[model samples]
Target chain A: MKLYELIIIGAGPAGLTAGIYAARKKMDFIIITEDIGGMTKYSWDIENYLGYQFITGPELVEKFREHINEFNVEIREGQKVIEVLKDEENFKISTKTDTYFTKTIIIATGRRPKELNVKGEKEFRNKGITYCATCDAPLFRDKIVGVIGGGNSGLDAVLQLSRIAKKIYLIEIKDHLTGDFFVINKIKKIDKVEIFTNTKVVEIYGDKFVQGIKIIKNNEIIELKVDGLFVEIGSIPNSEIIDFVEKNQYNEIIVDCKNRTSHKGVFAAGDVTNVFAKQIIVACGEGAKAAISSFEYLKYL
Target chain B: MEKKVIVYSTKTCPYCKLAKEFLKNNNIEFIDYDVGEDREKLEEMIKKSGQMGVPTIDIDGEIIVGFDKERLKQVLGI
Candidate 1:
């Protein structure tokens, strides 16, 4: 097995950016990722990505892919890194199918959506439920659907579903919608969407398909009949595989200014890191810093 | 070759793509069902694996949820 200079763990914003920089530096590196875009694919509208005033998450990620494709880097897409073991001088990155020995490692494995975990959530999954609003919104055209959570994700789901679904029911456990005021202002114009605050989705009722959901609003259980349900509460970091890495209370990898993690020669970037701002631009900056840092660390050996 | 291998996956899901790539690299002939696209395939995958997560592999009658290479090798006799 050939030992590469660096092996990046994810293909999201940070991983892709790192790949570009590594290729420019003429580093013997390969990106082993389960997918190309990571969590960035779920963003409905990206306004703060710097270049483009407003581009969709998937759209921006596509551009990132196009830029990375210009380089001579090899991206082993769809490979989930199971563990990264440190051995003396090198690191062993193991995926579900393959393993690699590398002088340095970059972990950009982002996050996955948080599940509803309510009754029938499992039973009705993919049947009439989905996490991505932009991806599955078209499927619910002319159909009545429900959106759970009250944050930006939930509001984003409503925005997408509003364009297609006949009617939408937005449910939030909190007393008020905590999303941006601009988004709330946009939602106000939609007459078909009914907002239910301080509501908890206690149960999802379905058998072969999703029939409806049971919600508790002001201590009263009400069943809202809908064809689909989009749960967009939040996301959890994909840092479970690397148990050796030091993580914060939220399970985000602990990284310094240069993207160096708790372990030597091992770095993390993107939303998976303890970076305060989990933005696309921040991820890219951190990824570049990580690549440079990793290159500098490689000089010692 | 006697056992049938079927993979249920989504397009955007990285793990699903990797699972399929692993099988292809091993030269295993299998049918891939895109759960994210097809409603019927999604239902079929759920009924078989009882998992909401993508990259569910169905080897003959055995249902393996998520991408597990060690398990796949054992089942495939690789």
Candidate 2:
């Protein structure tokens, strides 16, 4: 088997940035990812990603793709890394179809959406429950929908749905919406949007498709008739493939200032790690740092 | 006869792009509908699939929702 100098196991902001850095350093590396953009592609709008005043998620990811295309970086898309094993002095990555050997690995697998786990969620999945508003919001045009989550993700979904859905029920389990103040202000002015804090989804009920959702607010169970339910309840790190790395309470990989995981020759970056901030810009910086750290580690070997 | 593949998608959807790219890369010929603009196709997709989601792929009369790569490979025999 041909051993690579480095293998980046994602193509999000962090993984792509790491690829760019690795290529510039003239390192023998390849990026293996299930998808290119990761969670960034699901973003409705991004205003703080530096250089660009305002851009949509897909648009920003296109630029990332274009930037990486400039480099001779090899990206194996549609292949998800299922396992990572440390083999003596090298690391072995196993995907569904292929296996790869690398001297060092940079994990930037990012995160996946967290499910509400309420009843009928699984049965109604893809029926009326969707996690991607960027992909499915247009399907609910002129229909009624409910968005769960109060963070930036939920707010983003609500913002996207506002322009399409006839009425939106913004349900948040917390006492107040925790998204950016600007978004909250904008949402308040949308007459079709109804904000419900201290609310919890008790169950999702439907027939062939989603018909309504039962939510509890102020000890009262309210059944909301809706055509669709957009789940924006945040996400959990995609850090389960490798078990050797140390993780925090939230299961996010713990990384040092150098983006090094507990396991040597294995580094982590982006939303999968316990970084202070989960921003695109921050992930890109961490990815670069991880790539540099891996290069330095490879020098010692 | 080759399998009939139709992709109901929107331009801004990443998964839609992925689905289309996957088919194109595999040398599979498929028809793509921009349901976001084509109201008639959008309604046709919704009526056929009974759901509203982009990248709803129809492969030889089998409706596969979303970009499930493994499922796609299984259905397409790729």
Candidate 3:
């Protein structure tokens, strides 16, 4: 197998940024990701990322890809990294169908959306309770739907569902809506969205197709009849594939300022690390930091 | 009809993997093609479904896109 100076996992903002910097340095590197865009591809619009006043996450990452393409960084898309092991002097990275040896590895496999553990949630996944409203909103056109959570994604789902669904129940577990101001304002303008703060989804009742959802808010339990339910509470890191690495109680890898892991020659970045914030910009910054640190570690060897 | 299962796919697609897994889990055999690698088949896929995305499934000529596991199970009677 060919050996690389560095190997970067994931292709999200963090991974892509790392690739840009690594490529600029003319380092021998390869990036392995199942999709060129990670979970951020699901995002429709992002006004927070710097440089662009407002742009879609996918569009921004496209620019990152274009920049990295200018260099010789080998990109292996449609491949999921199955294993990462440290050998005597090099790290062994294995995918489902291929293997590679690298002097250093950067783990940037960000987080994935958390699932609603309600009964029938999985059974009615494509049938009703969905995580990506953008991907499945058309399925509930002119139908009643419920959106759980008060985060940015939840707010985005409410706004999108408001356009397609006849009635939308925006349920939140907090006393106040916690999404971006613009999203909340947009959702407010749409009278179709029924805001229910401090709400908890107890169960998802459906058979073959989604029929309704049960929620508890402020010591009061209520059932909202709907055809679809979109769960957007939050995300948990995608660390299952690398669970062998030392991680915190929350499953985030503990990395130093340079993104070095407990194991030598192993580094991690992005949402997989115990970073203060889990934003696209922050992940990208961390990815750059990790790549630089990986370069320094290579010099020591 | 012996449950005609047809998988419209691209040569390089990861979503097609999930769709194939769905068929395999149900023990349903399917005929698939790499439309991305074949220009004629790519046009056929677009014309048949008017979709530009890959991993489109045709169960008894009913069109579906992406993995769409649930819809595949329902249409294929899996």
lDDT of 1 by residue, A1-301 (tens): 8999999989988999999989999999999988878888766568888879998776787698889989878999867888888877888888888889998999888888999889898777867888866656655667899999889988988987787789999998999999999999999789999999999999988777788999999899999999889999988999987877799999999999989988888999889989988888988998998999999999886
lDDT of 1 by residue, B14-71 (tens): 5566678789999999999876567788778768865455678999889887768889
After superposition, the stretches of candidate 2 with alpha carbons farther than 4 Å from their true spots are A51-55, B1-41, B56-78
Highest DockQ model number: 2
List TM-scores for all candidates, in order. Answer: 0.75, 0.83, 0.73
lDDT of 3 by residue, A1-301 (tens): 7889999999888888888888877789989998876877666568998888887655675677788788777899889998887778788888999888998889999988898787778677656676776655644567798988988888978877676688999888889999988878878888888999878888888765678988888778798999878889998887776655689998999899999988888889999889889888899899999989988888888
Model 2: per-residue lDDT, tens digit, B1-78? 689999999876877887898899999999999887788998788889987777889998899988888899999999
For each candidate, how many residue pairs have backbone atoms clashing (under 3 Å)? 4, 0, 0
lDDT of 2 by residue, A212-300 (tens): 99999999999999989999898999999999999999999999999999999999999999999899999999999999999999898
Fnat for each model? 0.02, 0.51, 0.00
lDDT value for candidate 1?
0.85
Checking candidate 3 for backbone clashes, the offending pairs are none
Q: Is the docking of candidate 2 incorrect, acceptable, medium or high quality?
A: acceptable
Instruction: Provide a comma-separated list of chain B TM-scores, one per candidate.
Output: 0.94, 0.96, 0.88
Please provide, for model 3 over B11-56, each residue's C-alpha lDDT reduced to its tens digit, 9 standing for 90 to 100.
3344565578668878898988765345566557667775445577
Error of 2 at A187 (Å): 2.9
Which 10-residue window in model 1 chain A sums to the lowest lDDT?
A132-141
The deviation in Å at residue A116 for candidate 3 is 1.0
Query: What 10-residue stretch in candidate 3 chain B is worst by lDDT?
Result: B9-18
